[model samples]
Target: MRCRYPPGMPFYAYILLCNDGSYYVGHTDDLDFRLGQHQAGALGGYTAKRLPVKLVWSESFPTRDEAFAAERRIKGWSRAKKEALIAGDWELVSRLARNRQGA
Candidate 1:
């Protein structure tokens, strides 16, 4: 969903599509700045090495804890699930989750 913040500072859980076709999940209060850091290699970590990462999806949360929790949960998701989320296909995401649980 689009990042819409409440009155106070907002937290965001975001997914980045890396150059190597991998996904990177993270949470931050300053989404634009954090994305800049990843793109510039200033973060010096996973996205740094991947270079030229593009933001695929992001959601805003009222609390940092909630955003962090979302990041952790998304990190555990399969690539297909992530793709479904990026495509705004909630039905596919739910289906994939159910199939994974059955597996």
Candidate 2:
């Protein structure tokens, strides 16, 4: 808890790179602790067997709901979309944005 997060915050959005080259998206109030759990095989549910995960990306949020929303959206995204987010490519993100306005 050395992290100086403002009090009352409850979640974060994070990405983990599995040993199989697949990416896992998730959200947690304590990123460090959660990562440790995954690495220790204690939280080995999804990332458990997919051990040796590396922290690839993370974003902190003030609320669990927001973080959960982000995690859900990212989980459904294609690999290219995930890569674009990792590369910080706003252009690519926009180009790949799904057409929701089914007009």
Model 1 per-residue lDDT tens digits across residues 5-65: 5567889999999999999999999999999999999989898889899999999998889
> Candidate 1: which pairs clash?
none
Q: Give the TM-score of candidate 1.
A: 0.91
- Report the error of model 2 at residue 25, Å: 0.8
How big is the positional error of residue 28 in model 1, measured in Å on the Cα after superposition? 0.2
Full-model lDDT for every candidate: 0.94, 0.86
Worst 10 residues of 2 by lDDT: 94-103
Model 2 spans > 4 angstroms off? 1-10, 98-103
Q: Between which residue pairs do clashes occur in model 2?
A: 44-48
lDDT of 2 by residue, 1-103 (tens): 4656566877889999999899999999889999999899897578988889999989888878899999998998889989889888978877777543332
